[model samples]
Target: MSPRTGVRLVTIFSAVVLAFFLFGDWLARRDAPEPLAWYETYRESLWQPIQDRSLTLLQADQALGRGHLWMISADGEPALVSRYNLESDDRLWQAQAVIGLGAEEMESLVEAQAWEPGIRDQPVSPAVGEALGDRQILRMSMIPVEPLELNRIEGTFGSPDVRMPVSEGEAWVYPRAGAVVAVGEEEAFSIMFGLRDES
Candidate 1:
């Protein structure tokens, strides 16, 4: 009402607004996430061990070249990601070919062929079969065989109790882990190492 009272109230309001802005700015700067090195990123932490091992094997055999590495977000956390071009990368194909199968055992895959049973039967190589059997799911970066090939793999495992879409692909889920393959014209590949639950 009074000029003096109005002036006092305006002064108080200005100071409060100034303080609020200053505090907010300070808090934002303090809580900002720090930039991480390639190895320290979340994707790296999750996938680096496999990448390093693969690289080492390639290096030891004198076939190592520039390997691919990139960053991705996993469950809202920063993560490092890498994938091998299965159809193109000879070294990777060789390494993955030998992951759990011997040379003869690897050749056994030729005998395994996708067949259609009452439900449907997909044939998988012994190496793929063994990896599928042991790990129950491939790692995130492993190349996906063709869908027909994958379907046969799933058929070998029996139909998934529950199948659902994750992102742009479908996931054939099992009890312990889930198999997700991205199917699209642009990206028609499967991650042999399916996405696992962090829980």
Candidate 2:
């Protein structure tokens, strides 16, 4: 091709490339995610266990309502719970034995007792429910209850008459003001655990 023609083609190509880049930037700017306080709260709640415990045991934050966020470890170990109140930017959580125990502790427990997940599986029944402190705890047969997600009385707080089930599960038990639920911009909801129904 002639030198003049070559120069013209190169100039046109460069202009097209520059225009595409500038337009792309503008498009991205328009479609970017908004910076919402909820998002920041979500991200902050996600990193709590990572900061307090090990990231390897990080689990899914299943509960997201009002303004609070909850996450549970897969192994039914202690869960990383967090409550985010946007009104005043308040956050709280419980990181110890939320589900089970640490990996090392769990390993030791299993090695010492020959206990493990599914080593002995039993249907969740009302008797078991009573043991869990919920006298009315009805065992919804085959209701898709994850054995690990089920809540039980930890030896730490349960009665001495009944030995705590050395297994995995979770209890969404909260007192009147334990689980904070923020609604809209100003409303709030709270739950408080009362005396265990022994009936």
Candidate 3:
């Protein structure tokens, strides 16, 4: 074969191999399931709990599925909280729910040996589970695996009701919706849902 012909054949073979790999990559990506978006998860899993005054652990489980429950003191108040690692497109986002317990429920949980300091894997006693089942969820928070685009926050929730300057960024509060979004220069870093005192 002529040198020029051999060179042309080699170039054609390389181009074909490159195109085959590119097409395979595209196919694999297209077939893979896309991870849930933060906004969608908020609307679906968190919105109802925040809106209803009577949401409970049982109801939350029905909405968000069973998660890892822990005994905690939130804002100096004894509370039970559950955390779930939510799968997202980029990474696992964290969802937390804080459940407020009454005096009686707290006593029951204490007696049931539910509170283990610094340990989250302790098996929940029947009494502890019963006590937590009916308690109200005071707040819910979603921490994205990656920072959220600033425009996405504004687009979903509209402008903030209050904006406070912080060391890293600004905190945008939407009291009516019971939401707080901590925004950095380019993106939002955190989102919380619960009632906040205006003052």
Candidate 2 local lDDT, residue 121:
25
Write one digit per residue (lDDT tens) for candidate 3, span 1-199: 9999999999999999999999999998785544336666656456655655666777777776777776665544455678778776566678788877778767776667555455443444445555568777888887888887766677667778889998888999987677888888878887888765455
Native-to-model Cα distance after best TM-score fit, residue 82 in candidate 3, in Å: 1.0
Would you estimate the TM-scores of all the predictions?
Answer: 0.30, 0.24, 0.63
Better of 1 and 3 by TM-score: 3
Q: List model 2 lDDT by residue over 139-199, tens digit each.
A: 0001111121111212112222322222232123322111211112221222112213333
For residues 1-199, could you state the per-residue lDDT of candidate 1 as single tens digits?
9999999999999999999999999998775543212113323333333333332323312222323432333454322222334343221231121123344543443234321223222323234332332221124434534333444334334455566666666665543333343444334354333334444
Global lDDT scores for all candidate models:
0.39, 0.31, 0.72
Backbone-clash count (model 3): 0
Residue-pair clashes per prediction, in order, are 10, 14, 0
Q: Which residue pairs in candidate 1 collide?
A: 42-79, 43-79, 43-80, 44-80, 114-123, 122-152, 138-192, 138-193, 139-193, 144-190
Cα deviation in Å at residue 113, candidate 2?
A: 40
- Give me the runs in candidate 2 sitting further than 4 Å from their true place: 35-46, 50-84, 87-199
**Where does model 1 exceed 4 Å of error?**
1-67, 73-77, 87-139, 145-150, 165-169, 182-188, 192-199
lDDT of 2: 0.31
TM-score-based ranking: 3, 1, 2
